[model samples]
Target: MNWDSDELRAAALKLLLLATLRETKVAAPLLAELEELGMVAPGTRKGEFRLLAQQEDKFRRYLSVRWPEFAETEQAFSARPTLISAIALRALRRAPLKLPAGITQLNRKTWSAWAGAHSKSGCATPPPGILLTSDENLRLRPNAGLQIIGEQGGTLDADVCRALFGELIVPERGFSRNWHVTGVLPWLVLTVENIGAYIDITIPPWLLLVHAPGRNTLLATRFIDRLPATVPWVHFGDLDPAGLDIALSMRGPQTGRTPVPWIPHIAFELLETHSLPLSSPWPTQHLPQKLLEHPVLAWLIAHQRWLEHESIVVLSGLVEDVTKLAEMLRER
Candidate 1:
């Protein structure tokens, strides 16, 4: 295994953390390099290595000399990497960051530079518990707000309402900030997954349509949380494992409401008439237990077939019957 890997380093750090208190035993294979360095001796039992208390200081010194990153203090052990910690500390000092135009306009590389981390994925996925706002803890300031197709009718805050220009509005601000909706509310909220299907579907007057992009349900969840707990929500997405998980993740914790999976009646019809062969094996292990036992998923797995939401929108001519579909969901 790579000696400098996080897993190896974390194992080494654990040994250092505990060796001072008593003889610490770890799997023999995990510390082969430490054994080679004469820092760990074979334990009393088979397939284990013992780090003696006397060797703890020598081990820490060796790591500090060779790999300083692994020589972290006890407090820093539970914390993020040094670079990430520094960035989070700075961000906490300037909590509730002002981004009038939202995080999308902020440069990724600039964010990385601020974090002192590798410039690729650092900005995209920050440590989840770090950057805390006055009201909520956020990983990254939302780069995009939930795209919506419906009228707020003075329900939305004045500042947010001013940002609306047309039938579809993607707010330029983060949802975790001051954005909120009050007063009158939609009878039902339908979260659509794909952008193509999101734009294509005709929304009924009583229904509020919000785009729930795959795995990025942050904004959508925040928007739903602002609504009353009784406001019913449903989800429509591709008939697949990932889509089902996305729908599951859309459950609003604040409202204590789990959105009903809106597998339109036409979806099953299209699955039978125009279903496509699975291009790749469905990673069912990634699915939650609820989805694993789902009848539709079981049928899809048995048939090795999957259907896209766009197909249901196109082949089923759902745009015309969307109002009736809304009524069906409300009736349920």
Candidate 2:
């Protein structure tokens, strides 16, 4: 059965719970945290319930009575995969988990795919309208085809945010042979390297999409020259510590625009909160040097690390705080 299918949901949930248990003990406190983050939720706690255990009878009893062929946890994890409950951590840190017989390869590739496919962490599936279409290349398009459901300052949720990273969305007007530059970007540009290197069937090292290497200066001087005084140019790339650092670096003297949050905070908060099985662990140090000088970012630099999309999701709240950060820095 497919990982996302109803038939596999119970197995996935059991696996996630079991995996988390390897590290921590599953109990009420952990269950409370999971509920807050929308991990695994059940009715009022009565007596000592078998949360997660190897006892076959105990495990079966809890499922048979409380959850019938579980299918709801996936939806919970899908929207908020980073909401790591104690149960999850407990399961993961426990005994080594084996992916059933013949399902051997627990390689990075498998883990990455599983995280993307399962609601246990990250998005359940890629967002709609964001496609690997056109010369069959990955493209980041506008918010043309996505359905905005959330009422936050941003409507695009984590899934939508992930989907639209570097993939093109809206096609074009007049049906002209075209490439789309979504949003009123300040000065973001795309360049092709090793272009035309793949003529025959050999795949080239050239990726369909990547962050513009240099900061606003080189990026502006070279590919995109003109820009309005006040513009929001989001630099989207892979969701990693390096990606967050790069976004953080593209600020200050670069664009001259007071760094508003153009990235998403929801992504990182969920990633950390859920303690999702990482393809790569979130970096302890990822903020740019200049940002590291700021007290708020410096604090994040000190011990906490924000993941991708956090800046964008939390931008509105951050603008007012920038002044506070400056004040604190000045005192220092």
Candidate 3:
């Protein structure tokens, strides 16, 4: 599409601001800065030069009209590792509404801010830092280094703590492995534990989100990089195929998470009766064979399309199960 010279100039300025700098600036002077840098090619028309001469409120609409076709902020952020004032990123990600009315809306703006804040070159890969955790007392800063939650660590700003992680903390995962000790019965909640109580008995990430990093153990990412693999665990997820999948993922060879079915086969039967899997695609690949090998899980996977722990009836159920799981840990 043919863009007026001012529009092109405005577009160029945006690229420069997002690519090189983290914030926005008024036009005219910013354009002068661009001209000095040779970003403005010599042949562009004087009418295009009007971009440098125009006020933001006037030219802003022109840019807004071209937003979908031109904005590359999200793409830009995906290309790098960035640092941002902790507060800003949080505000943008959770804000009920994004900003700017058009052009770079809140989502794009936030993502762009992240890109600029991160602004790393392609060759250098950035690692995901811990975002937030339960336990209001806990805090982790990029430069301050890692804080093993249960281990002796430094203090965090209380305000930042509640803001980042929610005030009421749910264990930060939806997928997890459930296990049973020799004496533990099927219907009862089983528990897993690390030395003290790292992640008592929570769902692993993979069961819910795709491509979660299971801990580097027999269990899934749930146990990755942790010092204690022997935590007593409890089974408190839903009574369905998906929960079983989560339990199964946690168990088996390296990531030894076990499947301890709480309301075993109840959801599986309900799902099959409702003809679930027949309605949707079944997960054939990466379906935890070990957890499936458990008589109950196998039957459900074969009959149903999907089931999740969330389908479980009670929220308090997890708390009760966790306590039981922890009690079992104290026994060990």
Candidate 4:
């Protein structure tokens, strides 16, 4: 089942098209393949085939196992066969540049048109070249992998911006590809993984706070890339494997000069009291090598405990601890 192969995918799609039809002629070799796969049985006449009435569930189950995306398409087709068929036919005729729009251009329909007309949350499986949003709106994937969200302020170079305007929030429009912090560099750059913790944590005049948001690190890494190599970097996130990996991902390639986990001694001390039990088994296989060797991470793994950044932020003396962390990094 090398589903990644283009030839295989095309063959699978052809089989799926046959399955969708109530009564349709199929190529003999294709029918033989279907019969072998338990989807169809040979008919009385030669070169003829028919799907068994009792094998409908089996056929669907087989599709679900072999091609889950096709299974989703099959479900979507049942709801709106005409729309689905039209989209499929349009895709087959010519690949669409965007999504439903490229296929539905003549009708002057938007991608959200499908949602409004058919009550579908989204296209279950987009055609080969098209991309769709959750609400079935056609959208091209952004070149920027992840958008950076954070707050900035303090005495910046006059050229950077006209006025500080107190603590300036990063504009919702996000930074451009060439965007970088220009002016007096912050004493420390702190990347936070969770929005709640990022907002709750106190930001000092000498600190630049960035929202990394889980495993998506493109914008965060780009922001860090623009910073002076001498600027100390640190990450504050969950105490789980994902948090450790995020910190590792943001690390500088220059060996010793990289972002370090901002877990202070207080965090380790509070772990036993504040930490939550692992809801699911820890995925050890995916852990970064550095995390696997980390004494704190190892202890957490052994004890099956994880701490959330929000929990640590809510603790007393957290502000002091962060201040102390900045001071220590400054001294380093």
Top lDDT prediction, candidate number: 1
**lDDT (C-alpha) at residue 299 in model 4:** 72
- Cα deviation of 174, candidate 2, in Å: 14
What is the lDDT of every predicted structure here? 0.59, 0.35, 0.36, 0.58
> Candidate 1's residue-wise lDDT over 34-86, tens digit each?
77878887666665566876778788777676555543333465453333333
Better of 3 and 4 by TM-score: 4
TM-scores for all candidates: the values are 0.51, 0.23, 0.31, 0.51
Candidate 4 clashes between residue pairs 3 or more apart in a chain or in different chains:
none
Candidate 1's C-alpha lDDT? 0.59
Q: How displaced is residue 40 in candidate 2, in Å?
A: 66
> What's the lDDT for candidate 4?
0.58
**Candidate 3: where is the Cα deviation over 4 Å?**
1-7, 10-111, 114-227, 233-275, 314-332
Off by over 4 Å in 2: 1-232, 236-240, 245-288, 308-332
317 in model 1: Cα distance from truth in Å? 4.8
